[model samples]
Target chain A: MAAVVEASRGERDNQDQELVQRALTRDPAAVAALVRRMAPVVHVRVARALSRRRVEARGRDLRADMEDMVQEVFAALFESDGRALRAWHPERGLSLENFVGLLAEREVVSILRSGRRNPWTEDPTLDTTLNELDTDQQSSAEGRVASRQRLDQLMDRLRERLSPLGLHYFRLLFVEERGVAEVAEETSSTTDALYAWRSRLGRLVKQLARELDDEEEVSDE
Target chain B: MSEDLPIRVAQRLREEDEALDPRLERLAMGALSPEALAELEADAARDPELARQVALFRPLSSELQDRLTEQMSAPVAKVIRPARWTRWGLPIVTLAAAALLLMTLRGPSALPSYAGRVEGGDVVLRGEPTPAAQGRRVMRGDSLLTLELSPATQVDGAVVARAYVRTPAGARAAPGVPEVDPSGAVRLRGVARELLGVASGTVSVALVVARPGALPEPDAAFAPSEGPRLEVQLLLR
Candidate 1:
């Protein structure tokens, strides 16, 4: 039974290699097959990323942007003499499919990361509102100053609450822009554990923000 | 050189894949030495289709991290603290605040509380299920409860880890979990009323996706960043 399974696995790997080789030659049929085969995988990754994005952004629609991300992944894989695809060395242990998948994952992560940074880019109306606010200098400047003060207060509170390790994690991740693996290694934790700790901290801070908002709302009322 | 990053990212991303299917935990954990990871990579290469599914989920993993940072570090975010009073005085003030909050939450609404029945066909939100509307009321009887997972993305190929409906009476596995297409629209036909014995009050619907595996318990509070689960509560009239 194990031998039968191994035989099938070898056969599948051979087929994958042929497809990728043909694809590298820019054979339209091979390229098309590659895309058709990979599209769902790409779409799913992009879709999942966007879905999480929609949630974090408070339920804004992100579907319209999905195609762009998927296309970017394909382009990266097939572009420049199929550099990305050619780089896949099955002999080294990863199959061609997984190699391409790596590309798709990277593309989706890049898109999600960028969207998180600006966010307004995902919705033009938000950008327009900010532009409008900028033109209204007197009120905007006053608002900015007030916002800065609030930020200072929030940071002070955060510093007080975070453990020394947590604070260092934050600084390394955000301020220094270190990767999760690097930070995890430095902290003597797995990436998953680091994620959980960070999430716990964020929830605490968000709760604090929520209470402040509630208090202000009551005062206004 | 740039290729190095994706490989590392892919190694890290197995964390999500493992969450969906514990069998992949070996890959998910960075426990593999470089040589071992390479062998695993070769194995993954043989199955591009599987690799793609696993890769697509990496974005969700990254998003979870992004969300944590976004929530806590946003400029002008505030943190509230109690006034500087005696410890006992603070507790008293906190108790007063808690009572006030409870009152506000349970306060009368424009819509009535769940009387234990939904009157109409299930209200479905396709492509993107929004958060449940609290004040919204539903009729109790003859209502078919349905949920649409939005941006159904990979649902067509996704293995349903577990799905069900729950209510005050009890919990039951849904007769049919969401059926999705390539367009990422999953339609779960409603048998929730029967399964949940949901004669009245509130019914909670939950859907969790994973690779094929043993059925897991339903998580009502599941969020995407928590892995692949969607949950919404409906208040019936």
Candidate 2:
């Protein structure tokens, strides 16, 4: 019985390692499996938080509503063809949770920007949205090999730090693709307030990644 | 930083990003300091997340290149927009003039988008014309012509061109901490051509005169220069 149990345990470890390897190779099947398993966690977290926001807004066009923002996040992540899913590279601090959080933060920022004009007094017409576009981002072939390795290591570290609650938030925001208003209405908060919370939570996730990077850096040194 | 870009290009990026839905242009010069560009390049190759971020920047860069090509297009200069007063006469004159050389706006409202060295002459494109009914006018010195834009007007080329304005950029924005901005000297650095690619055209003209408005100082976003006073032309899809 002991020998049989050992064999089973060894097999399980092998399976886990194989999954990790597949993910690193940017395999679509592996990526889809991972997304299916984790997307819901993101949805639940976003939904619960957004519900709180919906209650807070008595009725105001607050920019960066979580629910409104979440859908775009999933769409961008999953995209139409799903090319980006397989391309996800792990960085020192880019945990799956953190990656989702980064997407959330970026989405919110864009949302906030979409509605808000440049806040300059003198130049009311001054387009505040400067050159946000950086052209031609293809990396040189020379550095890609090392960069890919480093990125994979980073993703591994990032996935490990994701908490269940954080995972849920990602699923809510990324998978369910809920609007901030909808989330706020459910949670009894305003979209504006939800924006603040989303920002804060996203910040926390980044802090965790930073800590992870520090750990990795130390190990490397 | 990235490679050195033309002055018109720098100006356009400073002025237009989301407005002109552009494709990616791998920034070659000046947008990023060489060291920073190198550092980021290294990061991108190794970092998938970073790579994704880098990819996001492509469309914008491509737009810049396209704008430059449009700005420097000799072919466009040779073709002229037909004038309302005469049948084919206006276009032929403009095209003839342009094929010989790109019109130089002697006064303000000239093609101001070109960098390095540009000639002086004006192509007055004023008043509201019918949608897609192209017209061209020779620069009449002081009276800057305005191309009253019709929805979905795609006016390109010099002879067929209504007006050309190139606003030279000077100054720079603080590094990092992006803000919604157009005409940011810092961000633009030294753009050579800012092609105005307009989509779902509105009453806004693809090319317009800056009038007598004074440009801002080096520190100011709107500082004016004494040279040609053309604006960044808007191109339509």
Q: What clash count goes with each model? A: 20, 122
Task: Using TM-score, give the best candidate's number.
Answer: 1
| Location of the lowest summed lDDT over 10 successive residues in candidate 2 chain A | A1-10
Per-residue alpha-carbon lDDT of candidate 2 for residues B1-237, written as tens digits (9 for 90 to 100) = 112111222232233333321211222112343454677778779975445334333222222222222222223212222111112245445644763453253322232231111111222334544322222322222221221111111112221112223223323321222111111100122111221211122112222222234323324322344432222222222
10 residues in a row with least lDDT, candidate 1 chain B? B110-119
Runs in model 1 deviating more than 4 A are A1-7, A58-60, A114-221, B1-237
Residue B169 in model 1: shift from native, Å?
A: 47
| Fnat: each model in turn | 0.01, 0.00
**How do the residues A86-173 of candidate 2 rate in per-residue lDDT, one tens digit apiece?**
3333321233444555444343333333444211123322122111111223345324533333332333232344433333343344
DockQ of each: 0.02, 0.01
Show model 2 residue runs off by greater than 4 Å.
Answer: A1-32, A44-56, A59-69, A80-88, A116-221, B1-237
DockQ score of the complex predicted as candidate 2: 0.01
